[model samples]
Target chain A: MKTVLIFEPLDFSAKVIATLTEHGFEVSLNKDNISIREALEKYSLIYMRLGVKIDAKLLDECNSIKCRFILIPATGIDHVDEQACYKHQIQIISFKNKKELLKDIRATAELTMALTLTLLRNIIPAIESTKSGIWNRDLFRGRDIFGKKVGIIGYGRLGSIVSNYFHTFGAIVQVYEKNAVELPSHFERASSINDIFLNNEIITLHVDYQESNIQLINSSNLMLATKQPVFINTSRGQLVNEADLLVALENKVIGGAAIDVVNEELGFNPKNPLVAYANHHSNLIITPHIGGCTIDSSHKTEEIITNELLDLIKNEV
Target chain B: MKTVLIFEPLDFSAKVIATLTEHGFEVSLNKDNISIREALEKYSLIYMRLGVKIDAKLLDECNSIKCRFILIPATGIDHVDEQACYKHQIQIISFKNKKELLKDIRATAELTMALTLTLLRNIIPAIESTKSGIWNRDLFRGRDIFGKKVGIIGYGRLGSIVSNYFHTFGAIVQVYEKNAVELPSHFERASSINDIFLNNEIITLHVDYQESNIQLINSSNLMLATKQPVFINTSRGQLVNEADLLVALENKVIGGAAIDVVNEELGFNPKNPLVAYANHHSNLIITPHIGGCTIDSSHKTEEIITNELLDLIKNEV
Candidate 1:
């Protein structure tokens, strides 16, 4: 039987290894040595997170090991060499089913709403301001989220849930989806990508991690947007061209942005380009890409993966 | 016929002022000077904001000012000298009708939901983090409002609307009204204040401004509730005792707080006790007392006051 391996460091789901093992398949977790290329010959199936890059060299080793499947245990497959996988005849599966993540998606959508209101009302600044014992209510004469135009790109799970908030708040909800898929009965769909840019006062991205959706919000889309829209990217970092996003904020193409993902090659720090832009632009709000986070979501994600692995080992295998 | 003189500082509504002018009342707005004593003798009805002090001296000057009806623009009458008004036989006519601020209350309740969701999911922080390009997705994990327990301390107009958000989020909603007043059908009213404090995961205060509801959430109340409930106050400033609240955060008596009001003599500033507390504690959030501050709410408030003043001038006279 083929062996399976998980190299990604995670603080959850202990049952995955046990389930795969029950199927009479040899299984081992690369906790001590996570360098995939060096250890590729040992496993037929491999799963890992974004930071651990799997390139052509790893694919060659996997072929030597007669590997049949490469599972990237995340939503985005930016770190994996897809062409290499194809050449090696490795079947690839990335991202959980959308229905599986609906609860978490709703959480992420709700988080975006919270952040938007906090930013608009200057709640953080007000909190910071009051820490020093100064009363500045007038300074925090913040605007309400009600009746604002909110544009959502990638009308998938997260985008759809966010639209509900906008609608409830009396905001005009506009959605941008490349597929032109029929949306929920309640939502107002954006006719085209340009339409999302043209009509929305605030824009949020919720597209999944297919190749087409990657880098979807580039300079052209920013230019196409009508009144400078407030951009948000909780979907994935690769979906937005960070440099262009920064430029958009700097050059005033968009009003501001609230980001949850960015290019990992850029690194996460105070001096990062987007961070630099956010600091200067009071309008921009940044977060450490926590849309998929939340203790409950993490636990649930692990449970789902483990259960799936168990089912495959117990019956499908 | 009584020549009722009206001294209001801001611009009078065309319709409202017209009603007074067309009737027997003579209206004068203080555009040049802000002398309370001088303005008192010239006006029978005094319209004022937080800045104006309707005291004994002013009331004595307006002794001949029949009815001595003082119309306060906002709900809270902390600024109004009630003792002086009573001694001088001033009939304080605030809003006996909650209908006057129904629009505003609804707006505020929706706003509170927006802010609460934002804070709970680290949405604002995520925005700031993302804007800065940090993309620390792991750091910004947030919880959804769904399946949570939300408690409303005072189930008046604002509380009823807020409770509705919890219901929409699929959360269990409970309310505690000191007077045992029944709330909306959706709301599950607590038989006692202890029940709310005992079971609720998130507690919001919406009691009216009066002696009965003052300092309602003291050390004892905080002790009875869940160890950590998302706390919010959009009612009176003095309702939650500041010292007790500060201690609650310090001891982790509650999970977090989102404040719209505070007990302070100096007014709101960035460097207040609550602000100081928020900085030290990750879960504390403080917004200026602006629950009813949406564009929709402001416009509604304008209409309500306009209609009320106009009706009083024309119909009463």
Candidate 2:
């Protein structure tokens, strides 16, 4: 049988599994963390998520293996070393270029809004207060997003969606895109990143992960937060300097923050300053990287990727 | 000097206080829970919020008092006995008739959407998990609001705002308004309240409180929730039957619920079953009545009502 290895446990529907089996494929799911390189040697196709990092060394070790395709059912392929995949001639299939498939995938954007509201409204501690048998609304009065100045770092797929959401809620949205992208009529284009931080009350990051843009939000830009904006990041953990974020929260340079990604998220350390700060502070809310961890998005993406993969395999045979 | 008593503690700006004092008004803020009837006997104008329950008995006892006007810095007149006010010829000054002023008060609506996303995204527990040094995303996979059926009860001010918000998030919105109200072209009007519960994946209440509509969401209508919708109530505590709601949550008749209001919110008893259930289970999320508690809303409403009361007093003098 044609061998397939799902390197990460994902919610694949029964129908998708049945279809793959009928097509002469033996599907094996990785229940426990195992060596991906060894599995790649035995399996011709490997289905993976963000859990495993496909670095240059791993791809080099599996270069001579039967692994021909690395199937990633997500938009960002930053987890996979694209340069190394090209060197090994292994095909990396992802939803990065598939705009049609990703148009309906709003999990990440939804979480961005969720984090913003949760942070702004003090929903976390408020819920905790109510759960602890206290009902003091005075203690947890929240900031209004309505008529507030919200700054968007990147006007890409997720950014645009979030900008629209904030705008609908009566917020004045300002965009700061590095590469020139057409903005909606209502959105104000920030002159510079510093201007964005200086003017807005809420700042969110949604930039695609790139080496050039690493540590994009640091002390330099964060220092210009004159309005003390609530910083939100749902993109990648490497995008912001967590150390600088800790300083900003401590000094009240920014109002607060809600983050879904951490720098060392794969094997997240509790020792991270931001995580530790979030444990005690009401300003910082840290969710377990659940931006795209929705059942609806998972099922749809899995089914679509599976069908597409089957078609490609059929064509090759 | 004209006497005025602020019966409830509110965030009145320094400018407002200056303005009141400059206009020959002797303002006294109630520092303790003194009897309103005694205060009424001394002060001609009394400012209040929802903390005090104004009934016919209290109004009758204070009927012969010098108090001629009740200044409520809120929209809801349900807390005050409107009939008694009319019977005693005491004018009620509130935001109920100020559509122009209320157009910008989006705090409650924002909170409604906040609660919905918080519940649907499993944000509270996810944050707690991350705080406790757990990074398991699988444990908190959320449901998407996108492409889900959302049923909105009441298409009034707050209800319509929430409907528009849900629709913007890609939800198919179905509104159930008891009285005839014009809905947007995109929104579907439900045949009955029962039909709304049966069809939608998420249900939110925004209806006004009325004696006729007490316990509107009981076991009778909750039984029809075939989709097991997440119940959201930001409207009023009295609109839902607490006993029936507890039973629905326990039986899984409804998916989960996030409520900002409880029936016994005034001096709230934490012994309530919903509060007790929320302490243990992740399904029920209870927030203190923070729906209208926003800095922006509070400031704007206070200023508006204070100024309006001053204008009335000026005209009467």
Candidate 3:
């Protein structure tokens, strides 16, 4: 029997396990996060999520290279050591560039709108105030999304979905993308990045993470935001300069920000300026990278990845 | 000279004041919330919002009725003493049934969507958790609105707008209204109130508040919510029975609730069960009746009302 070890089996559906078992694969569940070395010695195939990082050092510790397949049920492969896996002749399977499979994966786009709505409506403070038995509506006066000028940084899948949502709410959406393409008649194509920052009332980032675009929203582009637009980042933490964002928020250079990712996201860093600032001020709202943390999205992604893995194993047999 | 006393002049814009001044109508702002008797004794016209209550007792308290007009820049006239105004021939001018003037007044609808997004995304607790230096995304796993069935009660202006927003977010929308009307091809017309509560995963209320329909969402109808749907109320507080909602929430009869209005809105009542429950539990979220509170909405309503008032006064002169 072909043996497979699933790290972080909490969210893995029973249907996937049953399907694997039916196909003559003995699946071992890793509930307590056992050592990778032990797992490598036991199973030839491994499945993991973003929470568990597969680095070079961890791979080096495993003397016996029994693991030949690493299945990741996600689009991004940053959590896995791709170069190390390539050298070890281990194939990594993921949902990267699977357009048809990802057409309905809209949790991230939904969360982007959620963050924008919460910040624009002052929902957090307003609810807190009501919880404290105070009924002062004046203190939590917020701007309406209707008739506002919104700029989307990337015209990708999530970006287009979010911009369409804003457009449905009567907002004027302007999109900036590297790839030149025709857009809907209502949405304007911005000339440059500065045009998005300078002209719009709210700006959101949706570009993919790349080494060349690290710290994409630094002081230079942020300074051109004359409208004091509310900044939103649901893309990647590395895309923004944390120190520059902190300063921009403190000086009121931007209206406000609602972020789903941060630079110091792996561990609790006491000196994280954004988290510290969010604690004291209402101008900033942060979530712990939950842009795609919906149960429906998880189930769909898991089902697709597990079926694809089954297909690969069947071919090998 | 016609003298007008604005009871709650805090939100009264300078443009409205200047326009009133331009029309030769003397505007006196009552910033301190002066006595109703004093205001009635001096001014020939009174302008107020929802904060101030005009009742029969207040009308009787004034020995002589000098105020001839009560101008309200809103659709609801429940705050004013209509019977007393009629007896004294004091005309109560409001935007009631003025569809043209209210075409773009969409603050309440925007707030409805905001509250829905916040509750569905678990954004309030997620932000609080992140602020406490926790990065566990699994702890705050929320349902996506993309494929959820959302039932909207009352297909009025605000209700239709909110339903459209949810539909745009990829939600299945079902609407229930009193009058038989033609709907769009995508929207499903719910057979009855029970159809809305029984079949949907998320239900929202947007019915107009009337004496005949007080306590509309009582325990009887709430019991039919088999899906434990998230209940949203952005309409009048009196439309829902607060005591019953508290019971439903405590027993988990409903998934959760996000309410912007409450029964006891005027005074700080310690016994408000919803507010008390919201303080300790995450299932309920409350806001201080801020549905119609937005700078843009306020400006538009004020401008339209002020212009109409000027026309009336000019014709009288």
Candidate 4:
């Protein structure tokens, strides 16, 4: 009988356990086991999502696992220790994880659009004034999103989703990718990253956090972006050079930004220039990485995870 | 041939003039002439939109061409001088101005969705923080929109359009209307307005500002809303009671409000409780009426006016 240990609590984990348990596989759930010491006791395989760290400190105890396989339940490889797995001669398996991906991407894209719209409409200032009992139309007057151009990087799921919405709203949405990807008929694909830089009034990043992609939106790249395209990233924070983003925002190189993922997921320092700027300026929007965390999507995610684990254990899929 | 004297500046006034002029009717363009006396002396008909007052002063000066017709190109009749027209016996002719109603309704619906999304994702505060060059996710952490029941009042074009978008985003949408309306297959109409008030997490008003509907949302009505329902309105300001809305907002009868229409349209004053409350709280968001003022929509407004006038002149419709 095969055994699998999930290092983190996944959505729908109960169903996944049921699928596995009824199938005669020994399954150990690890909701509290974030560290490597707890991981060392795993069986033949492992499954995990965000928040679990698979780093060198924990890899030292890998010999005790007697596990043959390692699994990453999502696309990003940030938390997984690939080199450690290779050295341990463990087979690695990864799923596209569409349920999580779709939810996260959709949530992120939707939030981005919301941010852009609110920013354009001066919704915050208006809210602030209304609270203050002030009705300064001058402070809250806003533009609409009917004819603006939006540049989207990483024409994957989230980017594509945002594209569909913006296009529907009559925004000219352009997307870019290192590899060719088919977009919905309405979206315009830009061949070069530079083209997205030149033409878009708003630039959103949805690409994976490849090293090459990391710091990709640093000083020079942001400088290339014409007149402050509202920079957005829901994928990974490192894809943009936060330091450079700060300078650009400070200097008005980009018009504004709406970011869901932050480079420092640990905590934000108000002392930082960007952090300080976000305090006073009316254009920059920063959210902790919460794109896929909507209660609606989260409920769906829980269901998918449970079913996937159940099927795998039961040999149903 | 009958003629209508429309006021200064509309989107397609030129086209309207061309439509009416080329059809063998003498043209009395208002851009070149602002004198009501001159207009009354020349033209027999007048087209109306917003911004121009048609009070007793303007209606008193008609002589040359028997007060033939007052054609309102827009839906709302609030701008028309009804008493004056009635006294002078100027025949008012208007089919339901479907184009203006639908276009404005659609735009308003879109704005409501946009506002709702922004509020849920904390986009306004985030944007303001970002633009000021700060990153404060703590202050702006927000909830997702899924699982929330959205109550739509007056399910006409605006209400219906917004409901469709909300449904797509995975919200449970309910509607309340005085007239039995045929909704798309996916929607379920609440048996009564209280059904929406009791069940929904959000309340959006699309009711027009007629005498009967004024103050429809008074103290008791506002009290009917449950679970801190966020209130949104793009319809006329009079549909909601100012004092009742303020009390509801202050006492947490509803969660918060996002309004584009206010009882005080000229502006909010120090004496207004809404203004006073808004200055101290962050939940209320107020916008100057610009939901349908997007560039694209504005162009469409002009097109509608121009095309309709041309059709009438050419007797094409």
Candidate number achieving the greatest DockQ relative to the actual structure: 2
Supply the TM-score of chain A against the true chain A for every candidate structure. Answer: 0.79, 0.93, 0.95, 0.80
What overall lDDT goes with each candidate model? 0.67, 0.87, 0.86, 0.67
Candidate 4 TM-score, C-alpha based = 0.71
Local accuracy of candidate 3 as per-residue lDDT tens digits, B218-279: 99988888998999999989999888888888888899999998886777575587888988
Q: Give one digit per residue, the lDDT tens place, for model 4 in A1-317.
A: 88778765444346656766776778877666546455655577776555556666677755475766666545576767778877766655554535343454255667767767766665666666555555554444445555678888887667766776676665788888787666777788898777888888877787877777877778877878775677777778878888888888788888877677767654445465655666677787566565655544544454555555555545744
Which runs of model 4 end up more than 4 angstroms from their true locations? A1-105, A136-139, A218-229, A242-254, A267-271, A276-280, A299-317, B1-82, B85-107, B124-141, B219-221, B246-253, B279-281, B299-317
Worst 10 residues of 4 chain A by lDDT: A97-106
Residue lDDT tens for model 4, B34-65: 66556555677766544455677776655543
lDDT of 2 by residue, B1-317 (tens): 77888786656555656777898888888887678888777788888877768778987776477888888877767878888877877788998767567878999999998998898999988998999998888888998999999999898888888999999999999999988778889999998999999899999998877788889999999988999899999988999999999999999999899999999877789788899999888989999989989888887787888889877767877
Per-residue lDDT of model 2, residues A135-219, tens digit only: 8887888889999999999987889999999999999999999887889899999988898999999999988888888999899
Query: Would you estimate the TM-scores of all the predictions?
Result: 0.80, 0.95, 0.96, 0.71
Tell me, by lDDT, which candidate is best.
Answer: 2
lDDT (10s digit) by residue, model 1, range B1-317: 43343344333345556665665567666776646665555556766545456666666766364546666656677767878877776666555444445543355676577567766776655555455444555565666677778887776677776776677666788888767576768778887767887898878887887787789888888877664777777776788888888888778777777777777734445455667777766687766665655444544454576567666656765
